[model samples]
Target: MNRSNGGAPHRSITAGTDFLHLAIEEAPGGGKSDWLASRIRLALADGRLPMGSRLPATRVLAGELGVSRGVVTEAYQRLIEDGHLAGRGRNGTIVVGAPAAAPKSPARTAPPLPRSVFAAAPGTDVFDTMRTARARIDLSPGLPDLAAFPRAAWLRTERHVLDHLAASDLGYGDPRGTPALRRAIANWIARNRGIRADPDEVLIVAGTAQTLTLLGRVLRDDGITAVAVEDPGSLGARQHLHNCRLATPPVAVDSEGIRVDELRATGEAAVLLTPAHQFPTGVVLRGSRRSELTRWAREGGGLIIEDDYDAEHRYDRTPVPALRSVLTENVAYAGSVSKLLAPALRIGWVLAPPRYRDALVDAKRFTDLGNAALPQLVLAHFMESGAMERQLRHLRRHHRHRRDAMIKAIGTHLPSAIVHGAAAGLHLTITFDAEFADTELAAMALARDVKVHPLSWHSQRAHRPGLVLGYAASTPSDIGEGVETLGEVLRRGGAGPGFVR
Candidate 1:
């Protein structure tokens, strides 16, 4: 085993070193040490002898190389003197540093989304692009006070859950949701939104976006080809419906909420609405409008997909009950923690009409098996412990401060801007009675390191130029600065009459 070569004539010995099979050779001259040092240098340059790699013992290498210990020791000393290796006494000789590397070309990276993306109605990548855009302050709507996530309470609940969880609980959960979360949601909505639902009736989904998708599929299969949507409604929601191959017909929404007569005129048997607090506009469905809608639904055998988003964040308005509270048979209600906690937790609940509950559950079963079960348990625990209620209270006070700051700033800065949906929700939409392009203003704001959404992106018909700004995610100072900047931009580029209402 010790004899490496055939030993027929003679061969220069090569070391069986542990340094990735490094070998040693003595040439015609006394050059073994030089070859050893050169190899070590090359390995260091190539990162094989990275910093902290311990070299093999000198005695072992010398024996393997059939060279004197002095040769190995001399080579190690040369590396140490050159500052590439260091001796650690009994530990071993270790690589200390490496040779300077040559400069390399910069790596390729994707270009930023063109500002033209915001010039028209937003596409699938619009939200992603806006999120990734570099901004000093982001006032784009549809986010809550993410900085106030109850991490401490969540950890406490998580630990408690883990300690009590059975092996089966960690396995694939029912698509309808864990009994624990469904029960918690049943209790939650009943208590908060005045809607009572059985635990089995609540189908857990991956937030409102997925809820829309699943509903679209079931509704289409039910021979409902078209679902009427509120004009100037959520562009994201409209996109979700359109993606599922459903025709989204627009109905006009005035200050009080959706015009039921116009909705009746659309001839659509199904409709999607944000009645608790309308998206972007924040108008609660009027008492008369709600009654009229329920009457229409009962008469036409229609379905209402109620997006009960951000209704819990009310500051100055009387709490409007969710449509599902009264119109249980016709309304399919959806709500999520995206606005309450964070969008990162893609967890939401959908309570369908009895006729479609089973079908929706099956779609959810095949969609992703189910939302990760552990988060559902954590949320259930969080809700039962009253942490969610406390969080809402905290968010209301915090968001109200930012909202007040924004209103004051707008009044002082852009006095001609009409602020809509200020009494509730995380954001306020302001429309300017001007002819300039809101999309151009949004692009200009992004260029100045501020991010905001143009209102035209959410509208299907001609309307005054507007902007939807979120204050809940930012500090009062940021809100003020952002509104002031908007005013400045407007002043520089076709300053329209600004009125703060």
Candidate 2:
């Protein structure tokens, strides 16, 4: 019998096991089982061996460590008794328990956002801060009914895609986008937005925000300095352009959409417009204004960036054709599922003029190497299968009930406030005739746990004080409570003497 091996190895200076680099040398002469149990406990505490991870067999590990079988068996038995592992007979040992994670240090925790965020002039991070701020009732615009996201449909589509996905398809995809999604988008836009485009011409992007950033870079390279934006337009969009060092000269927007004459007067070669349903105001661009805008683009060599957001959520009005449908040569059309499905998807498409198409693709290549391939494929299938159409129809019916609820609440509680853009879209804009700071009202309402966007935040020039309130995500009961709370806040703060009826 090899009596020396029963105690310890004399010839080897360093005996070790390959699994988790377990070193037998680190154990005391008679404490091998204790050291092994300690190392395993540490591994479990630090998450190296998570629950359900299969461990090496006692015999195999004993051979690897040049230890007797009984030594390894004793060590595993200790962990099994401690409930950190379980013996599964032929399945070997499996990790069954782990220590609770240590609490984070106070220094590592982020401080709560300050209320002054609403008081200060809107900055690039203003929206980011407001989103993180605590609130019980959020009426922030530009959000759809997120609770209604089609999780079942998405999961089913995702499973089908993964089941049929090729190994090669997992590699880097086309910078332009997957051809399946491009073709699907072409068909989708033609049917819904009235924009007929070749699948080859479509460029997939992260969202409308990325669309602005990429276009800003490309337009700068092409020697364009400034892009006019509608006054009281999307402040977030304006901020993206400003971050790219492009000046956003303000052009007034009225009931008929952006003032093309004011846009031309700015002397900027390019303009960004949300014509289908203008932000905050929610007015459609009249046909005559569309003609003037087209003439500006064709005759004056202007570029139009059409943001067709939320056009699919109409309640009362007929569908408006996308601007890209009319002016193919100079219009750069952008649309996203942010308003249709959820903003978390970050999927949008861009159709640029022939001159900017190639440059835009190159910009996309360097920006993030194109959007993820699988989601594009999944969305493509969802659209082609008529699931997207079904989703739209469902959202239309669901949102209409909530919209009507909000309208009724406003009429009952805030009758003095005049509402705009209620015929279609996810939100309504209400303006007060009397003078008061809308931001102050918003801050006070937020203090009562109600969140809203001050209308002045979107405007570069003077405008009537208002609030943009979204109803799509809230239940009818909550909508009623929130509007009633706003009325209570208004009465307590004595907003503008009294809101004009």
Candidate 3:
């Protein structure tokens, strides 16, 4: 009698398949199919073979395991009968179901975030927390029409860059940024904002946030202890400066933008400003005030950190030249695509005065080895190819319509509310004569699943009760509905006395 006919393996021999490492020697005498089925079930229970995973062909697995085809076929049939898998003709077997998963331990789960995030003074992580909070409508400021991101144009430019990329381009890039993107940024600001700069003057950063961070460090190192910020300025920017251990002495902002007089009164060596389009307030720096600010920077020896954010998103006015254009020696200008494009790109540029230029570059060199080279190259191509200009024109048209719809809705619903910053930027600030806290209104609105920032969150001084509502990211219908909901919330006395909805 031949042992081959009986299919009994010798004690010295063993057979195994790569599919789950199935071993014929591990099967009981004359129970190969049973053992194989048990192994698959174990794999399913432990999540090794997840749902929708395709199994190897029975014939191929059988050959690998040195088993007869019938054994593999029978094993597959067992799993099929158990509803763990299904077979498609010529498509091989696939996992169609998995065993119920074991329950996770209570200790392994994260605790829910507190709902009091909007109740008190917002911490540094407040924005991070709010972003993750659940809500039906997000009217958060500092966001553009994210849905309008030019994916096709970006992809086309990305592909073009990749096709023509040099092998050396993949290595470590310039800590300051790629020359292509720097040149593109230089030309971009020149044409759009009237700022003259060489590509070498541009230092690509993560975003305006990083610009503040790096500047804060460099300023502090240079014996600067304070940077005066607009009273109703960006709380996030103020927080960034504060985190860098710099005191943010608040300077009042009136209709003429930041008060140059009060900024000088602060006696700080440097000041941060949103001059072209002031954050939250949306007031443009007037000509006289601009001149005064220039005099302060040039004559008073005060450094100006100009955040030229959202200068290109104007609707009802001609563009204002960036402060860097006239006070190039005293001003450090920063801009980013966060307001123009989406913030997710994490791309921005800083043009510091020659005094601080080397320090900023050194700070960037040690921080993340510069932004990823591919995106820098792609964005450079996008801007150089005139695609960014076209995108800006398209965003202006789209944002204008949304801004109009929001103004209309505010008028129809909250007639008593005073809307500010409507002339430009992605958001509008509406103030109320009510005595209630804006944080209370924000919390109430959040309770109704509408997200917004309390005006007080952006103001460090005593300011009017208001809310900052963004229109650029939402549809007309959503904006209308969100404003209507806010109206309803106010009518319910959420805004306290003197508020008329």
Which consecutive 10 residues in model 2 have the weakest lDDT in total?
Answer: 5-14
For candidate 2, write residues 394-425 as lDDT tens digits: 88987888889899999999988999988788
**Cα lDDT listed for each candidate:** 0.82, 0.83, 0.83
Error (Å) of candidate 3 at residue 369 is 1.8
Q: Which ten residues in a row have the lowest lDDT in candidate 3?
A: 5-14
* TM-score per model over all chains: 0.75, 0.75, 0.75
Q: State the lDDT of candidate 1 residue by residue for 83-177, as single tens digits.
A: 57766666567675675443354321334355555664456467557645767678988867665676667788899999999999999878888
Q: What is the lDDT of residue 197 in candidate 1?
A: 85
Count the clashes in each prediction. Answer: 7, 0, 0
Cα lDDT, model 3, residue 13: 13
Against the true structure, candidate 2 reaches a TM-score of 0.75
Model 2 alpha-carbon miss at residue 452, Å: 0.3
Error of 2 at 62 (Å): 65
Each prediction's Cα RMSD?
17.5, 16.4, 15.6
lDDT (Cα) of model 3: 0.83
Candidate 2: which stretches are off by over 4 Å?
1-117, 124-131, 494-501
